[model samples]
Target: MTLQTVILAAGMGSRLGRSLPKPLTELSDGRTIMRQQHDNIFAAFGDDAKITTVVGYRAETIVEAFPAADYVYNERYDQTNTSKSLLRALAATGKAGVLWMNGDVVFDPRILGRAIALIERDQSFVTVNTAKVSDEEVKYTVDAAGHIDELSKTVSNGIGEAVGINYVSARDKKAFMRQLARVGDQDYFERGLELAIREDGLRLAPMDISDLYAVEVDFAEDLERANLYV
Candidate 1:
């Protein structure tokens, strides 16, 4: 199966306070967040990568950012969530499986490689990269095998950190879009994916990830600290 990787970058990023989308915001090295993310993806897959970026908010900013990568706009990004954004990109491509990610995350290639390698080996399996979260960091719950147990937004107590990346197996484009549309009233993509796993009986695998992992940038402080790596 061919893999189409879509960067979910539809949010306005009110927390970053930038006039630009958070992915368009400049990293410390002077490279834009969007560029950094794309570069990492490109380095991983090179010519074999079928990359498409899902843009919203300042969609033009993303258009300007990855002039080479294909784009699909999610105009309802403000009201909806990443699941909807992902659905838009998936619909644009008539493919079977997709590799998905958050544009605002700071990740190393090893983490990305772990996820991609799983997809290449197992056609029907989903890969999750989870870290052991610190007391002060964002939290998630993980099953014994490291599949995502829960991405509780109100997760004040947990030991796992979701790496914000996955490879999805789509039965059909329409079915995936219908699943997304069904979850329009929900929070983020995790909720929708969970609902899919629960209702549609989807089971995912875990990437060989350890405690230290990528950080998704949401606030200025996160952007500031990520500066060192960017």
Candidate 2:
């Protein structure tokens, strides 16, 4: 299957307060956070995956980090969130359904490979990267069947964390983009998708993953933990 990756790198890194995009932040291994993720995805998927990074805030930094990759710039990144960045990139994807990922994360490439394999198995599905949540984790409530039942960080009512990776078909990707273009005003990726699924009744197939220690870099504590593990 021909796969493309959309790495969402549009955050301003408010908690880091470094006056730089989160993706450009340095990692322990001397590689920038964005460079590590780009290399991870590229190394894992190889020629099969054409990677596109959705950039904003310090978009130039992201571009400099991975000039070989395709990109979509989101000027409204400050007012919006992940979904908007996704929408911009998805639109630029034109007719291909690809994997969606977060830029400010540290994880094993095998986790991404698992999700890609699942997508290749079934075209009309969504494979979400999941991890066993700890005290420092953002938990997602997964049903016995492995579908995400709910998600929470402060309430501790979830079973796993969303690793910010998914495999979707071109049809669903187009539909999602269309819906986002219509009413993605809230700018939350989850909210836009929930609206589409609830109102439009789009069914998303779920794949359960167990091969990664994925950490999303949101705050200082998350950065510390991610640096240590991923």
lDDT of each: 0.69, 0.68
Q: Write the per-residue lDDT of candidate 2 for residues 1-230, one digit (tens) a residue.
A: 46677888887878777888888878777887777777777677676668888887878876776788898888888788777888888877768767777777777667766666566654544434454656654345544554444433443655455566665576667667767776645455655555556566555655556555667777887788878864
lDDT for model 1, please.
0.69
Deviation (Å) of 51 in candidate 2: 1.6
Worst 10 residues of 1 by lDDT: 122-131
Model 2, position 152, has a per-residue lDDT of 34
Local error of candidate 2 at 205, Å? 3.6
Off by over 4 Å in 1: 123-139, 142-146, 155-157, 170-177
lDDT of 1 by residue, 69-161 (tens): 888888788777787888788788775677788888876667666566566754333333344555544356556765555554556666555
